[model samples]
Target: MRLIAPFLLLAALPAFAADPTPEITRPAGTPQANGVVHTLRQIPEACARIEGAFTGQAAEPYRFAVVRTSQNCQPRARFVDFDKAKPSEAAGWKFNDLIRVPSAACPSQQAVVRVWRKPVDVGQERDGQGQSRIYLDDAMKTAAAGKLPAIPMYAAAMSVEGKACP
Candidate 1:
């Protein structure tokens, strides 16, 4: 009876277990790298991704740019809103507040720069040891192919002055 009770308890435990977190699947054409790509809050209607490269330099370690997921799909939102008033540092990178940048698609609306850093090394040691090297190499290939290196960080859009969509 003792052994049977233990088995029954174990079986019931799973029924009461908490639900697992949903897995976020990366969109097609997401840049592959050794380091982890932190998930960003996304605009439900808009599709976007973080595009940039690892310079592998001290003066300018990381360069990030937000772009649309597809050229044909024009989202109403222009810029990403991190909901931050000031820059925050994490994992050797400085996540900046919303900074407007010129947008070719929407001339009146400015795009936002969610992150930027000029850290020396950007703590390569912390990036999965030797992963940064692999990223640099992959970045070069992406650039050569006439495509900017990109990750799966989808930016949450912020509507600016003007009609949201053309």
Candidate 2:
């Protein structure tokens, strides 16, 4: 009876397997995105609307790239926190890879989900500050909550394995 009981328990147990490699998917007409996470900032005003909030750079130890000051919109060089090859000196806070979801911009609803990981080099976990998940859906909600200028929350959103996350 003991042997049979063990067999039954094993049969009833859920399979514990490692997460499979994510299959990246881009919707039709979605352009190839560079590492750049662009922002629609007021040309002469903000270098970036809220760069520290996104990408991977901390508010400190950061620089601006503005070659043509007269242009309305242009690409700028943003900083990164980690490389998996070259780690950042300021490692207190870091951004996980941008995960594209779906948004209202496209006919198909896809948005992106981004998160902050404080203390990148620390073992296991990080500090609570700047350590919450950021979702494009939430950004949409924020934008919708008020009336005025509506800046885009993300450059793009994608789907993988038929799921709603990047």
Candidate 3:
């Protein structure tokens, strides 16, 4: 009876612990059929899709410049610098690999690209009225899967800052 009681207590302890949230996978820089390299950006209230072209070699330590392709997008989130440094587990964001993107201005049709993501905070996930706020991580996954357009308009929007191709 003593051994059984201890096992039951251990099983119940898991219920009191918070469920672990899934981590978002790093985004890739693969371009879509329309020649647009789609990626995600963390906005104030939601995750946004940003289109851009790679500007250098398709290797580590690349740079991605934001381009203005859509009318419905956030304008402030611009520029991503991907470095070769190791990603820090303690930091909210980490460095990811470089990818090839289509670029017109660049000598080569392809350009180098890298991605960085910021960790989502628990408090920011909910609003004062207890309503859910951001869906950045989910949008990021969708973008990586090459299905950014399928996401609901409210959950994600288009974002652009400058012209990466021109």
Tens-digit lDDT string for candidate 3 (70-132): 566544343333343323435545333333444444423444333444434443356789897
User: Could you tell me the TM-score of candidate 1?
Assistant: 0.25
Off by over 4 Å in 2: 1-46, 49-78, 81-91, 94-101, 104-109, 113-166
Which has the higher lDDT value, candidate number 1 or candidate number 2?
Answer: 1
The RMSD (Cα, Å) of candidate 1 is 20.9
Q: Which residue pairs overlap in candidate 1's backbone?
A: none
User: lDDT (CA) for every model shown?
Assistant: 0.41, 0.32, 0.40
Clash count per candidate: 0, 9, 1
User: Cα RMSDs of all predictions?
Assistant: 20.9, 18.5, 18.6
Poorly placed runs, candidate 3 (over 4 Å): 1-64, 68-90, 95-97, 101-110, 124-166
Any idea what lDDT model 3 has? 0.40
Pairs clashing in candidate 2?
Answer: 92-119, 100-158, 101-110, 101-111, 101-112, 102-110, 102-111, 103-110, 103-111
* lDDT of model 1 at position 122: 34
Estimated TM-score per prediction?
Answer: 0.25, 0.20, 0.28
Ranking by lDDT: 1, 3, 2
